[model samples]
Target: MTTWMHPEIGDWEARGRRVAASGPTLGDVDVFVVDAPARTSEELEPLVVVHGFPTSSFDFAHLVDQLSDRRRVVLVDLPGFGLSDKPDAPYRVAGSADAVASVCDQLGLRRFALLSHDMGDTVVGELLARQLDGDWDVDVTRRVVTNGSIYIEMAHLTDGQLMLLSMPDERAARGPGPELLAASLVATLAPAHADVDMSAHAELQCHLGGDRLLPRIIRYIEERRADEARFTGAIEAHPSDLHVVWGPEDPIAVAAMADRLVAARPDATLTWIEGAGHYPQLEEPRSYLEALRAAIG
Candidate 1:
């Protein structure tokens, strides 16, 4: 029902459907969801992926098959991002967490391993909190956390990010076009990964007037700053096994965050993707996949 900026990505879009879900402090709305089934008959805990800021499920278009080879892989475009409804309402991490729960409920997913990138990490943290408090009814078997500002204080916020943060916490009159969004993403990758195609990611981000909602959705960063213990604390305290696969070259989240996670959870495993930055899955797909397989294996 929507016109994609680049029709070539239609196959990826075809794999997903819009589900009725609620957002932070809002009523039921359409949330874009993708559920790639397991290829093998061997039963394995499904993997539910939460994506980062300014991007959508399309981020994993290339890896969904490999990831689902052994178990199901579910991805959702949190409201206000991707092809989801971008209503001019206040956005928060808790609501995004609820959106994930709604999608999982619709799909009959009660337990799964978790993989999160960027802002998705914070959303997972909120879900973890709910599970601990007896709010949401789901089991997070294990976790693989990539680069995100879980430790807000330790983050190196990019210029573009700072600019967006400085804007009013509401829909902007105008927002970055696809080219600008693509450039910002490219800047976060390792130098050697400068050629990664971010076109579809940027286009999907700007869909349904999503460009104007960046300021509203990015408020999750502020939420992390205001309440680190609630988010990062959940990650540290959760009983699920934790494995961290990081791109040491990430300028924003920084390598120290992963080190701190290991320090907090002594038993947690940490794998570094050499020559890769914030988006290791895109920068070094081979190394990232190997590390992911090893983490879940």
Candidate 2:
């Protein structure tokens, strides 16, 4: 097993632990978890953050400190992504939601705010659905939906993404290596963020031979396409106050999706980070955090 050596990755791994999450059909799998406590003595609803596809909990490494300063923040690297174990099994949006629920159960979190991105948004939708169906007991005080195709139809699928979707839904003997994956991720960023070094994130993506699981992990997109109502519908129906924070320059999950989301739910608020793209939290952390904090506040 080859490990990627990067200072940031090392620091992030040190802050989290690998736990055996046994939830519904997902079975027992090792999931990476990070629980950062609040800095102040006050108690606020903990923030549970779910990362997007091809990445892990490390996506929020930049904002964890500030986010935790106000209230506890929890994150997880779901199976087949980040520092977690990558099983050669089919991945489903429901299973991902199960893993998240198991982690929250293990941590004893009854009430928490949700913050999700990309594919994580779908996972959040499932969680919300479970909550609505009375299958999950946790209370979602609020939610923040970042750059993701919550409205999959409105998204502009990149060529690489389209190609991935066309391939067999099984682990490839070989796949786009870390560098190529890194470049692909960087391509989604706004032009102004061209200088960002996404190498470390890509390195983590390749950790534990995860690079080869692209075909399998990317299956989540198919699930999204097949059943938007099951996932996206939960997001729309959940009574929690919705805050849509987006990067206007995102080419995939374009800005119009945000407008459509607010249209569906008139009570939901929309805030755009001007110069950022898909990964707004990474492209403009300060402004993103400001908008996030304001929304959750």
TM agreement with the true structure for every prediction: 0.97, 0.97
Model 1: weakest 10-residue lDDT segment is 22-31
State each model's CA lDDT, in order.
Answer: 0.90, 0.90
TM-score of 2: 0.97
Local distance difference test, candidate 2 = 0.90
Clashes of 2: 0
lDDT of 2 at 136: 94
Q: Which 10-residue window of candidate 2 scores lowest in summed lDDT?
A: 1-10
- The reply for model 1, stretches above 4 Å from the true place, is 1-3
What is the clash count of model 1?
A: 0
- Residues 1-297 of candidate 1: C-alpha lDDT, one tens digit per residue: 666768657888899888999644657779988888988753789999999998987877889889998898899998888878899988988888889988998899998999999999999999998899998888889999999999999999999889989999989999898999999999999998899988889999888778889999999999999988989999999999999999999999999999999999999999999999999988899899999999995
